[model samples]
Target chain A: MSAEVVPLPARAPSLGPILSLTQTSMNAVNQIILDRMQSEIPLIPALAGHLIAGGGKRMRPMLTLAGAAVCGYQGTRHHRLAAAVEFIHTSTLLHDDVVDGSETRRGQSTANIVFGNPAAVLVGDFLFARAFELMVEDGSLRVLKILSSASAIIAQGEVDQLVAQRRIETSEDRYLHIIGSKTAALFAAASRIAAVVAETGDAEEQALDDYGRNLGIAFQLVDDAIDYDSTAAEMGKDKGDDFREGKMTLPVILAYARGSDEERQFWRDAIAGFRTEDEDLAHAVTLIRRHDAIDATRERARHFAERACDALSIFPESKARAAMIDAARFAVSRGY
Target chain B: MSAEVVPLPARAPSLGPILSLTQTSMNAVNQIILDRMQSEIPLIPALAGHLIAGGGKRMRPMLTLAGAAVCGYQGTRHHRLAAAVEFIHTSTLLHDDVVDGSETRRGQSTANIVFGNPAAVLVGDFLFARAFELMVEDGSLRVLKILSSASAIIAQGEVDQLVAQRRIETSEDRYLHIIGSKTAALFAAASRIAAVVAETGDAEEQALDDYGRNLGIAFQLVDDAIDYDSTAAEMGKDKGDDFREGKMTLPVILAYARGSDEERQFWRDAIAGFRTEDEDLAHAVTLIRRHDAIDATRERARHFAERACDALSIFPESKARAAMIDAARFAVSRGY
Candidate 1:
């Protein structure tokens, strides 16, 4: 927990525009984040600080801030709410490192590695509780309801993913459902909360939620594809991490569905058998490319990005609206 | 996640009196629990069900139910709140087992051992979400605030415990604070929330919280003492679990303080060094008895029990009131 978070690779240029657009609210959100993360226990702030410093781009929180700006929210409540969103996200990252036994995340040693699993798990719970505290202080039962349910759904999605961990036969529908709940639900909540704070009508709220949701799905799809894309090293993770861990991502599922009998057997042997030969990663890559799995996955991302853009059609000509649309493009653009 | 929970030992007798007193609402709370735990992802329910089946006293939830009754409330909202209390307790227990790497609880397999650590951790999170869902449905900002703060404090206490884990130099004040936050905070929240539900005045609410806080401290003190007592097996867990784990409970602190120089060194080696000699437990028990540490610990519990009873004096004479007082007695009665 005492470990300092290593800074990320600059700001990942793709995120710069949207971040620059929402810079004011994002800065406010960051201040609140820094405030809520403090604790008398040095380890808590240390561990939380480590993750915060690891450079998440604060994407979900940025969504909250940006969504509020786009919805014309004038109050300071969104700052606290945005902080809550980041706390929840960071909390899950801590627990996820424990659950996944992951040692590295965001190109830095995960908190579980630096602080130990027990510290990670407990601090994660602390952050979660802090998130609830923030929302409760906000004094909106509706907002509380939205964020709390999203928290539950995100957990359910993680559990669902664990249920699918090594099973090559996990359905594509199940994959979509997992990503939607685990990733997109929070995004939707982040966006919708802005509307709630702004006292906007349901239509506008739903539009923002749709934009966030579709963007979230696209974001995760692009993330999954990047692991298999030729430039995975540029993504700051070792290529074939999902494969070595027997993670049944979209590309692996697609490749399995489209591969020939021998290739299917190869995947079964490599994935189910937990084989991590250097050539195995290469062969898996070869088969995925041959089956055009990465292309198809990115295509799915593009579709969702389009949907995200479509959800913004109701917004007036405004900088906030345009940046959100560009944010969708940024999500899909990372798939190389 | 797919594993069915093994049934618990026929219910422990200690909880019987409180259980009988709060029978009706407890039953209603149970129904809500069963209903809310249902999830399409069978794994969520499966892991959660494992912990639920492990036969906890459900004391915290029962406090919520009973506290509401003692406050002269007749509404059904307490049922959901009580269930939320249970969910929070169960969720922490799930994560606790993983953090402790414990294999058994309640004379049955712990959820982590039965469902796997990842499943236990994720399902624990799901239950937390479900608990929040239950509270949000109740729609009380005060309840949300109380419970959420308690949750955060509990996590802080756990981390403090982890930090204090092999250190014999941990002060008695630190130990009490740790236990107060980790164990008693939820109890206080559970009790205080019932008042919120009943719309009781702040004085009544504070009294109930005091009652629960004192009772909870008493409860944990007795439970810790029982581990080193000869009757630990009757308590359903192995004797010396805490001692082996180097937990700095009250008795241990007292024994360390009162021991001779040689005996103090023994304590240091056995606890700080994680060295468990075959005779160490027996010798420690002998010293604890010679120092009257267990008796002193029980005395402390009794003091708290009396304080708890005093807190309930504001209420009128009634069955609920009597039972509340009796519950305090029961908490301290488990020790020698």
Candidate 2:
């Protein structure tokens, strides 16, 4: 007997499914965020609210909510933990702006630029401490460990990126390691804690962790790809911030490795901070395009995204699982 | 009954007693510090060690150890917690240098000046995270809440001070409130956690908190006074740093408040950043000394030191209690 072949329906990969899936829980998390970010010091909330109320996607906390939904967690504990996750992310963003001297973020003035670096730095610290307070209130040692370890990893990753800056010889392995620590570590922790709250078994926890971690890698890869992609829309960040800062993201790493001798000289000069003019950025984009490095980076992201989706295979089929799978695919499809 | 007043022994107050009281436990705390501050990132440890290994006196951690001793607690948990206290202090100091743009600290180039501001900021973050991780390992929700709350307060105090900077109208009350948060909050938490680890009752915890809190205020007051004392020995920090930073310390507040019209204008211009030359600093010192602001600040410190010692009266008399009392007295007596 001949086997019948089936064709699946095609649809655009969008964040709609996951966002809607977790919307109610997200509102609760947002409420927790607003309540906890408040301090007697007015500037704390004012400066934090500038970015928190700004057009952030709240992507990390969404992972926690969605992870909990996928795990069939009925309790409200994830709400506080998710808020904690968002606070940690926000704290890092504030400090990141200070470190990068970034003037704008999310189509608005960065806290560092608007409030000044000292305020930004101190407020970042306040938010970080607040994040810990939220976790402590949750009263889970496991959650505390997951989040605190991730925080240290994120800080180390930041320092690693700083050390790698202005050096053209940074490899893809090192780049991945940095992003894994700085970005994926938090993502993994945010998702894993959902299982902790749900009392899910070790296998299920690992599944969620793998899902979040791989998705984080995919998300960051696409972000780096978009930085060098000429056809990409404005990312609400300076179009060439990565190049200007001499950051060695995956696109640049691949482009440099695949370049001609003269092109290699250009990459070295650009990454060494010798070429920062607009025209120099344009030329860098051209070189990146010539080697199809953006496409290669996206391809790498696709690999991780597929892994992210496959990680949820251990779970029974449900709308939450399907939405999470779409979220991974959406991460890879971003900046198209 | 004849009440005989026994005059106190005519000996200079010193940190010697407290240092000896906590020496054994402090050694363990130091080991934990050296171990925990390390990371796979070489620069993390290198930059952190630059400040940690620098002669910081480890005063905050000593409070934790001494509080444990005063509580008659026999456990190693306080060792890790004490190290965590020191980490928090180190983290704040590193960020403080960046915020103040300080070039030197503890007789050495600051992490910010040596490794760069970005490194200092990121490394500060690493140590802060590491501090939480240590608390998590100790598995005390109470300690976590104490330290985390204190940390938030400390950050708020820092931002408040930043807002008050260069404002000539800052009152002593406001200055006291700022120092209470920025300096004493951690001290209170550090001492309180020892009671938590010892399972001491609430009364003992409150007493230790009061002791550390008052001592911290006294310590900071002396530090501020020493900055303006012409006869004071070099205290390993730049002598005129607070003046140049326009920090509204108690001495500055007192001097500015008590100045003549022309001297008030000088104070205004100096704080407003118009007067920053060495001679300007010299003139400012002269004005502070002329008003006896240093002595007044030290007198204020003495009040807090008395309260700090009195806070320990609830505990039975022991070497630990006497040493702690001496430590408080020494805090007020510094720079004599």
Candidate 3:
């Protein structure tokens, strides 16, 4: 009992490396985003600018730039493509707010809340069309194919998620499938397009896609986990949104599987939207913690993050590769 | 003394010629539409099919087919392109229903009402993405650019219309501009692409574009006129919707401009949404009729329809050309 207990100390993973690696190109991408979002209709730019200027991590665009760097690409083509990827992401976010009736995003008023749902929906359409316009201007049918297919997949994934909402029995596999399409498909496309612009052959393209896809899973899992982790810092989104919305995320899946009969009954009622009060959310967080569901979700995320890092082993070691690896680690480690 | 009015009756313009001209190829386009709309997600097809099979006239796709016939296109490329055009049109219709919160369309419950706004919005996104996927499969960047640009213009026009809603001072020029962007842009693109597939010269492309654009304006003006024309047959939509929603259509613009001081006050309150009862709509309709605004709107539509027919003067006389001119006349003559 008296034996010394030592806590293992490790430096926390950081996005700083990846951020620095892609800084200049990210600026160019940002410029393209700003330039392309403009229209003769003032409302289009006003509503779009609110979210565009809101502080997002710009993770998807960063992946494009970083993938281009890892591929030893010297062209400036990725800049516009990266902008297109961001536009696609932003469009989905706007629509998501309308679907969810969300009030806050990025710790600020959502576009749907700031500009009414009608404006939000229309501007989302404008941005999505603009994204395709950018891809067309780049004259890459290949990129267009990748992004358009991904867009369809993302929409299907959202509809599937809507169908699964408020159902307590959703499996972890189904949740993974939903996120794979809704979140990871675009990530994979974003990274793969960089490889295409760099003229990297199939192997490298596949490698980057694998990397981005796995990292996207890890990121989404952690996001779900953080929603139920009461001890975590506030995220850009409102906390407990998934719980209130009855989204069957991984932590809820794990907690439901591990809970006692009474706890299971509670989950069923809560997820069916019968229990949305503060106490219900608190009980949910407590039950999730008691069953170690948050830790389990983080464990799953760590596995994917490791796979994501190993995906780059096909390429030679470089600063870009190292930074990308670090970014994957950060994806799993954030809000811990 | 009595005036004997001999009603001049030319054979009422019919879509018969155009319909027969494109019937065979339209079947091919229909097959493509059915084949492409399917997905493993059952709801996508169920919701999409409800509207796709909901007895729409397939006007936009027909335009594509008719334009192809007019250009004497020998190949089947226009079939797939026509399906793509229909998908774009269907996607916009779905979104429009959601934006307008419409309960009925085509004499049936709207997709938004049956499937919920979330499903309608997501399915709309899916169809829009599918439209681009089709374009990508065709491997034509020029067509992609045309459609994408048109899509953006449509979105902007919708936003502008939303801004103009409930504003009594909206001008006829503004209304025309909005319709030009929202409705006519797609028609112009649908027609122009046929020329592209035919490898016709720039002049031919411009002529077809002019034909479709003017025809679309005529079609929409008639649509607006029909909304307030009580003597006309019930349309495939809820009558008085424009009045209830305070949309600034041409009839409303002309009526607002021509109303007496007292009548103007009634319009001011009605357009501001303070007056939505049945009697209020009745009074509004009476004012429009008293001012002959419905007839004025139809007269405007006729001018555009004549321009549409004249646009075909450059082409040699043929079955297709004659059918297209009749189609223009039909655009103005419907619901007279």
lDDT of 2 by residue, B77-137 (tens): 9999999999999999999999999999988999999999999999999999999999999
What candidate 1 gets wrong by more than 4 Å, as runs, is A1-14, B1-17
lDDT of 1 by residue, A82-122 (tens): 89999999988888889988877877788898999999999
| DockQ score for model 2 | 0.83
Instruction: Report the CAPRI category for model 3.
Output: high
- For model 1, name the residue pairs that clash: none
Residue B85, model 2, lDDT: 94
For model 3, residues A143-204, the per-residue Cα lDDT tens digits are: 99999999999999998998899999899999999999889999899989988999989999
DockQ of each: 0.70, 0.83, 0.81
List the global CA lDDT of all models.
0.87, 0.93, 0.93
Which regions in candidate 2 have their CA more than 4 angstroms from the true location? A1-9, B1-9
Candidate 3 regions exceeding 4 Å error are: A1-9, B1-9
- Which 10 residues in a row give candidate 2 chain A its minimum summed lDDT? A5-14
Model 1 C-alpha lDDT per residue in residues B156-210, reported as the tens digit of each score: 9999999998898988889899999999999899999988989889998999999
Fraction of native contacts (fnat) of each candidate = 0.84, 0.86, 0.75
